[model samples]
Target chain A: MSILFDIAITAFLIISGVFGLVGSYGLIKLPDPMSRLHAPTKATTLGVGGVLIASMLHAIAVEGQVSLHELLITLFLLITAPITANFIAKAHLHRHVERDQLPDAAPDDCWAVHDIEPFQAGAEPSTETTK
Target chain B: MIEYAIYFAFGCFSLGLLMNLWQIVFASGVGDRVLALDTMVINMIALLVLFGLMAGTEMFFEAAMIIAMLGFVSTVAYARFMLRGNIIE
Candidate 1:
C-alpha cells in the first residue's frame, strides 16, 4: 500500500511537471511579452506549486513526518510570481511601449491599477521595488 | 518510487532552467524577463525541497523560508521601481 501511494505521488509530480514544461514552451513560443507572462505566471506557478506539494507529500508519506518548508515555499511563490510579473509588464509598457502606441482601448481597462494606481498621487506606493 | 519521483523532479528543474535561460537570452521585454527570473527562483526552491528529501533532514526548510522571503521582497522592490522609478532602499 505504501508503495502504491509512492507511485501515485510520483505520477502526480511528473504530470504536473509536464504542465510546467508546456508553460515554459509557451514562454518560448509566445509572440508578445504580455502573452508570455500569461502562460508561465498562471500555468507554471500552479504547475511548480503542484509538484512542490507532491514532494512534500512524498516525504511525509515515506518518513511518517510532516514538513512545513515546502508548504511555505509554495505559499511564497503563489504570492510573489504575480508581483514580479506585474513589475516587468509595467516596466515594459513604460520603457518600450508608448501610451499613444497602445491600442486605443480604454487604458484603464487595459492596465490593472493595483499597486500604485498609475496616475494617482500619494497612494502609498509599494516599497519593495528596485529597477 | 522515490527514485522515480527524483527523476521527475530533475526533469522539471532542468526544463525550468532551460526556459528561464531562453527568456534571459531571447525575451524582448523587461517584464517578461523579470517574470522568468521569479520562475527561476521558484525552481530553486523546488530544488531545495528535493534536497531535503534526499538528506532526510528538515534544515532545507529554513533555506526555503529565507529564499521565499527574498523572492517576495525582491518582487516588491521590482514593483516599486516599475511604478515610481525609485526604490526605498
Candidate 2:
C-alpha cells in the first residue's frame, strides 16, 4: 500500500523479531531458572503483541476490514502468560528452590502450595497462612 | 524493501526458535525445559503472524491463536503437576 504504511509494518515486524530473538537468547543464556522466567514472560509477550499489531494493520490496509481475531489472541496471551509464570514459579519454589532463597514471608503467610501449617513465630510475622 | 524486511525478520525468528529448541533439549531441570518451551511457543506465534503478513493470508493467524491457547494450557497443567504431583488433584 502506501510507503508510510509499509514502513510502519516493517518497523513493527523487525522490532518484534528482535525482541523475540533477545528473549529466546535470555531464556537460553540465563544461569538460573528464576532469571530465565523473566525473559519470555515479559519480552516475548511484547514481541508477539508487536507482530499482532503489524498483522492487524496490514490486514486493514490490504483488505479494508478490521481483523479482530488477533486482538482476541493478544488478550488471551496477555492474560495467560502471567498465570503460567505464577504457577511455574510456585512449582519451582515447592520442588526445587531452597526455602532460604525465597523472600522471607511472615509465618502465617505461607504459600498455599507449600502445605505447611502456619508456623508459630515470636519475632517474624506469621505470613504462612497456607499450611 | 518491505519484502526484504519481512525475510530478515523471519530469519531472526527462526534463529530464536532454533535456540529455544536447543535449550529445551539440553536444559538441566524440568522447569527450565518448560520455560524454554513456553518461550518457543511465543516465538512460534510471532513467526506465524509474520508469515501471515508476508503471505497476505489470515489462515496462520488461527494457527497462532490455537497454539497460544494450547501452550498456556499445557504450561499450567505441567506446573500444576509439578506442584501437586498430579494435574487434577
Candidate 3:
C-alpha cells in the first residue's frame, strides 16, 4: 500500500513537472500573442492541478491525515483561469486587433469589448445596427 | 523513488519559471507579458506545494492559496487596464 501510494505520487509529480515545463516552453516559443495565450492557461493550470492532487494524496496516504485545503486552491484556480484567459484575450483584442482584422461577428451581434454603447440596466435595449 | 520524483519536479518547475522570466523579458506585446506573469505565478504555486510536501507540513497551503488569489486578481487588473486604459471605472 505504501509503495502504491509512492508510485502514484511520483507519477503525478513527474507528469505535472513535464506539463509545467512544456507550458512555459510554449509560452516562449509560440509565434504570436494569441497563440502564446493558449499554452499557459490550459497547460500550466493542469500542471498546477496535478501538483495539488499529489499534495492531497501525500497528506492522506502518507501523512495519515485528511487535508482538503489543497482542494480550495484547486477549485479557485479552476474557476479563475478561464476568466483570466478571457480577460487577457479581450485585452489583446482591444489593444492589438483592428475590427476588420478579425473574422466577422455573428450577424446580429458584435464583440462586446468593441461595442460603442454601454448596456444600461433596466432600460430599453438599443436598436442600433452593427456593421 | 518519490524523493527522486520530487527532485525532478523541482527542477522542471524551476526551469519553467526561468522560461517564464525569459518570456516576460522578450515578449512582443503587453498581453504576452501579462500572460508570462500569470504563468510565473502558477509556477510559483507549484513550487510552494512541492516545498510543503518535501518539508512535510501543511502550513504552505494558505500561502499558496493567497498567492493564487492575488495572482488572478492582478492578471485581471492588468488585462482590464490594457482593455480600458484604467483598472477601475
Candidate 4:
C-alpha cells in the first residue's frame, strides 16, 4: 500500500512538472502572440491542477489526513483560466489584429471585440455589418 | 522515490519560471507579456505547493490560493487595460 501510494505521488509530480515546463516553454517558443496565448492558459492550468491533485493525494494517503483546500484552489483556477484567456484574446484582437485578418463571423455580425458601441446606453444597434 | 520526484518537480517548475521571465522580457506585445506574467504566477503557485509537500505543512495552501486569485485578477486587469485603455470602466 505504501509503495503504491509513493508511485502515484511520484508520477503525479513528474507529470505535472513536465506539463508545467512544456507550457512555459511554449510561451517563449511559439512564434506569434495568439499562438503563445494558447500555451499557458490550457497547459499550465492542467499542470497546476496535476500538482494540486498530487498534493491532495499525498495529504490523504501518506499524511493520514484530509486536505480539501487544494480542491478550492483547483476549482478557482479552472473557473478563472478561461476567462483570463478570453480577455487576453479580446485585448489582442482590439489592439493588434486587423479586422480583415480574422475569418468572418456570422454573416451580419462582427466579432464582439470589433463592435463599435456594444455597451453604449440607449444607442441604436448598427444595421450595417462587417463583410 | 517521492523525495526524488519532489526534487525533480522543483527543478522543472523553477526552470519554467525562468522561461516565463524570458518571455516577459522579450515578448513583442503587451498581451504576450501579460500572459507570461500570468504563467509566472502559476509557476509560483506550483512551487509553493511543492514546498508544502516537502515541509509537511498545510500553511502554504492559503498563500497559494490567494496568489491564484490575485494572479487572475491582475491578468484580467492587464487585459482590460489593453482592451479599453482602462481597468475599471
Candidate 5:
C-alpha cells in the first residue's frame, strides 16, 4: 500500500510541473502574440488540469476523501484562460500601433485574422516586433 | 512504471522552465513579461495541487485556488493596461 501511494504521488508531482514548463516554453518560443497565445492555452491549462485531476484521484483513491478546492480552481482556469487570452489579444491589436498596415484586419483590430501580412504593404510594420 | 512517469514529468518541467526563463530574460517589452508571468502562474497552480497530493491533504488545493484567482486578476490587469494604458483606467 505504501509503495502504491508513493508511486502515484510522485507521478502526479512530476506531471503537474512539466505541463507548466511546456506552457511557459510556448510563451517564449512563439514569434508573435497571436501565435504564442496558443502555447499556454493548449499546454498549460490542460496540462496543469491533468496533473491536478491526478492528484484529486490520489486523494480519493488513497484516503477515500474528497476535496473541492482544487476542482473548483481547475474549473475556473478552464473558463478564464480563453476569455483572458482573447481579451489580451484584442487589446493588443487595438493598441498594436501597426493596425493600419495589417493586411488581415477582421473588420476591426480585435478580430483580425492570424494571416496578417505586413510586408505586403511594401513597408515592414513601422512598429518593431516587440519580441 | 510510476517512476517512469515521474521522469517524464521532470523532463517536461525542466524543459518548460528553460523556455519560460529564456523568454523572461531575453525577450523585450512588457507583453513578454506579462505572458511569461501568465505561464508561470499556470505552472504554479498545478504545482500547488500536486503538493496537496504530496501531503495527502486538501491544504494545497486552497493554494491552487488562490493562484488561479491571481492569474485571472493579473491577466485582466494586463489587458486593461494594454487597452486603456493603465490597469485602473
Candidate 6:
C-alpha cells in the first residue's frame, strides 16, 4: 500500500517536471508573442497544478493528516492563469498587431484594449508553425 | 526515492525559471515580458510547494498562496499599464 502511494507521488512529480520543461522550451522556441503565449498559460498551469497535487499527497502520506492547504494554492492558480493569459493576449493585440491583420468586429462593438477585437468569429485559426 | 523525485522536480522548475528570465530579458514586446514574469511567479509557487514537502513543513503553503495572489495582481497591473498607459485609469 505504501509502495503504491509512493509510486503515485513519483509519477505526478515526473509528469509535472516534464510539462514544466516543455512549457519553458516552448516559451523560448516559439516565434512571435501571440504564439509564445500558448506555452506558459497552458503547459505551466498543468505543470504547477500537478506539482501542487503531489505535495498534497506527500503531506497526507507522511503526516497522516489531510493537508488541504495546498488545494487553496491550486485553486488560486487555476482561477488566475486564464485571466492572466487573456489580459496578456489583449495587451499584445492592442500594442503589437496591425489593424488589417486583426479581424473585423461588429460595427458598434468596441474592445476595451484598443477599440479592436483581434479575432473574427469566422476567421481561420493561425497556422501552427514553430520557429 | 521520493527525495530523488523532489530533486528532479527542483531541477525542472529551475530550468523553467531560467527560461522565463530569458524571455523577460529578450522579449520584443511588453506583453511578452509580462507573460514571462507571470509564468515565473507560477514556477516559483510550484517550487515553494515542493520545497515544503521535501522539508516536511507547513509554512510554505501559506507563502505559496500569498505569492499566487501577488503574482496575479502584478500580472493584471502590467497588462493594464501596457494596454492603456495607466493602470488606475
lDDT of 3 by residue, B1-89 (tens): 98899999999999999999988898888899999999999999999999999999889999999999999999999998887676665
Pairs that collide in candidate 3 are none
Model 2 chain A poorest 10 in a row by lDDT: A116-125
Q: Whole-model lDDT, candidate 5? A: 0.68
lDDT of each: 0.71, 0.83, 0.90, 0.90, 0.68, 0.85
DockQ of each: 0.57, 0.59, 0.68, 0.71, 0.48, 0.63
Docking quality tier of candidate 1?
Answer: medium
Error of 6 at A33 (Å): 1.2
Over 4 Å off in model 1, which ranges? Answer: A101-131
Model 4, A1-131: lDDT tens digits are: 98888899999999999999999999999898888989888989889988998899999997798889999999999999999989998998898888889898976567888875434545565678645
| DockQ metric, candidate 3 | 0.68
The C-alpha local distance difference test score for the whole of candidate 6 amounts to: 0.85
A108 in model 1: Cα distance from truth in Å? 7.7
Clashes of 1: 7
The better-scoring model by TM-score among 4 and 6 is: 4
Ranking by lDDT: 3, 4, 6, 2, 1, 5
Clashes of each: 7, 16, 0, 0, 2, 0
Tens-digit per-residue lDDT, B1-89, candidate 6:
88899899999999999999999898787787888898899899989989888888898988989999999999999987777666663
Better of 1 and 4 by lDDT: 4
Mark the regions of model 6 whose C-alpha exceeds 4 Å error after superposition: A107-112, A116-131
lDDT by residue for model 3 over A26-66, one digit each (tens)? 99998888888899999999999999989988998987998
TM-score for chain A, prediction 2: 0.82
In the order shown, what is each candidate's alpha-carbon RMSD?
5.6, 5.8, 3.8, 3.4, 8.5, 8.6
Cα lDDT of model 4 by residue, B1-89, tens digit: 98999999999999999999988888888888999999999999999999999999999999999999999999988988788665554
* Model 6 CA lDDT for position B78: 92
